[model samples]
Target: MMAERLRHDGVLVVGAGLAGLSAALAAAPAKVLLLTEAPLNHGCSSAWAQGGVAAALSADDAPELHAEDTVAAGAGLVDPEAARLLAAEGPAAVRRLAALGAPFDQRADGGFAQSLEAAHSKARVARVKGDQAGRAIMEAVTVAALAAPHIQVKTGAKLVGLLQDATGRIRGVLARIDGQPVEIAAKAVILAAGGIGGLYAVTTTPAELKGEGLGLAAMAGAVIADPEFVQFHPTAIDIGRDPAPLATEALRGEGAKLLDGAGRPFMANYHPAAELAPRDVVARAIHAERAVRGGAFLDAREAVGAHFPEEFPAVFAACMGGGIDPRVQPIPVAPACHYHMGGIATDMDGRTSLPGLYAAGECASTGVHGANRLASNSLLEAAVFGERAGRAARDERPASGPYAVVTAPELPDEALQTLRQAMSREAGVVRDAEGLGRLMLLIGDLEARHGRAASLAAARLVAACALNRRESRGGHFRADFPEAAAPDRTFVTLDRIDPAGLRYAAE
Candidate 1:
């Protein structure tokens, strides 16, 4: 079996979303193997991103203002330098994507068209065809990946574990392609796989992002940061979809309003900015409203009106698919787990605490999105950090030999559904000590029975972290401790994580 393995002298990247694509392109002239569980576009949340990348491309805006907004939205835990780096480098990254043929929306003056989203001080989101930015940018990057000479793409390849060397440094990946196991040895392993949104019963992410990337890194003993801060998008269209369709934040950025079942506007009651409040505020408001008013909804008729078909075609199509018309009727909405602000912690260079292992995209917590990510910043983070990780990985030296392969764990279908339900019920928007303790007990049982599936590990990390943080801030809202406390960012490695603590003593 050792002789059967294929080896590459450069980076082996797991996941083919924007981050992986950017990494592959950045590691130019080096041998790169890009692996994906689904065809390039099918499994990635990047393509489903309707909001554009946030950058200070407009003349009136500056990186300082963007950084300020980012820090403000992150609720006191944002690293100033990381936020500054994101705002300063974000414009160049957007320009690079455009150079690669991303179709950004342009104004009559031939400049990039920008829009405003929640928590931002200005209109800095660079969009494409209104709601098609993600799809368009991803399409352009995918084309570049396909044309790049150094990248070798392997679709339908599911990564099970990282291949580590005798010295505990990651050397490569152990993946299953077409139901057959394959080992690919490389100089470095980069996990750009994505977030753990799919761990919840209801999410607005791709169904496949079930905590594999974060779990694999954690299983390999990497530090996990802020795992409790799960950002729930306030407007996932409630259309009975498995992975709910998003009614993009850009709608509200453009002036859409949130309403209750009686068609009464409600956001104004929660925040002074109403529809323009930070995401966590809006999500919690919606959750609270739905608890009493039957349900919540987004009324875009007054804001978008007849322009819905032209300005937000993707959203229009989604509304049409669900037997709702955005032009006249209020679209049904719910709070769904949308983004993970917490992931395998990494630095500006995208290097994790472990040697030879790197992370980027939604899977890497660079301390930029401290506790809650600002609208449209996710794509920017992926681009800037993915390229950095790729460039850094390209310069690494290969391991002397491969590490021993271990069997990856899997939960029975019954256990998987139970885990999802438990996460959403306990670890979702509103959390309490009692619920978190119960969740920890359940997670312990699942770990004992399932042998640490990536999904289980990710769920436990979030639940344990949520239990430990007694105060509510940003995406993490503890019903038991609702008031904001002193600002503090959490950092934890696998050894320090004790779900049994309930208090997150290890944190």
Candidate 2:
């Protein structure tokens, strides 16, 4: 189908989550056309975030300490420069959101009430009422975005592909609205389309996300960094729900302990930080415990007890729905695909290899998170980098002209499901060369069969990258090669993938 032309003067931002909203707000005085696939409040993973935003807001806390903790949590692959930037600028971002009217929880002394989450060396996360940070922050940003004269929001619009010039500089985007494809010609494009969790069979992200932004950028030959790293939250409430409900890590931060069915604490045997260990360590420990016995759970009984209702209302409600009282019993738990630490490689300013294109949030890998992200850092990354990208985009003038809108290929439903199941089975929390190799072959076959839906292309990139890295570093664990190898980042572009080098036979 020929794309419909829609002209906009300022920037075109895909995804209306925190990053997209932040970008739109930062690019003030410049017109922005913000596209969202679902209703403003409903389909964003940002609203599901429970641990709150990590920032050095207390006088006793410092950005340097936060940076060190982030690097440590990332397991040696973190970019010190990016970590420093994220930490240094974190307070301002939090304050910016606060100034925009986000009701952050304050201490009795009127200071920010900061809590310590997994892997943090200090109690520095600025939370809202228990676990309401994400929802509250989004509500504030959404209201700000709606009232902004320069920002125009197009809800229920799905970004299908990017429009690029003959030399491949992105000029705009091809999006679908009410089943009709439309072309948006803009001066600059910012991709803030969240993470790849939706690509897995079981994930904490919205189902429609599915890495479309990552694939679109990659197909345009954008460099992808550390595509192999996918984080699995160690404690998602396993209540037989699609995209299982998340049990906030803040519970652990508040002293909830992980125990087996036998009522024995197991985290201490794995990491010194125990329940407060980095997510990867804790997730792996849970997976191992489950493999050995039945499954693991979080015993918040003694830690929070009756405080659960007042503190973590979301988790408390979910437990009540499952006929379990979190105040008394342990909540059944297991690891679920939660975050992606890697994405379209970008600098601190969020510029991609392709000119005229910028990305932020979970969609862009700015190398700050490295191998594993610290708890609540995803929100910080979105705010800090989203502002940077938005400002830089607004300052630049697009080189004159319209570009051809690239049509995205469609995929069969069966083929897409096969890919999701395969990824969840093989490239999930625990992995091995044999499974990863098989996964690559399956991805190749699916690509050939489905003719490359952006989601499938993204799945291929993640699976292929996971297969190539032969070490068990951070989230990309290799059971066969269960040790770190040299410790460096992995970068990939479409040109680098050689079909002949694949270990498994193509279907």
Top lDDT model: 1
Candidate 1 residue lDDT tens string, 1-507? 332477888899998889989999998878899999999888898999999999999999999999999999999999999999999999999999999999999999988999999999999999998999999999999999999989999998998878776677887788888777788889888899999988888899987999888988888888999999999999999999888999999999888989998989999999999999999999999999999989999999989999999899999999999999999999999999999999999999899988989999999999999888999999999999999999999999876754876335877888988988888898999999999899989988988887888887888889888888989999999999999998998888766776464655533
Cα lDDT of model 2 by residue, 184-222, tens digit: 888899999989987888787788778889998998889
Instruction: Give me the runs in candidate 2 sitting further than 4 Å from their true place.
Output: 500-507
What's the lDDT for residue 492 in model 1? 85
lDDT of each: 0.90, 0.88
Candidate 2 lDDT trough over 10 residues, lowest sum: 498-507
Roughly what TM-score does model 1 have, to 2 decimal places? 0.98
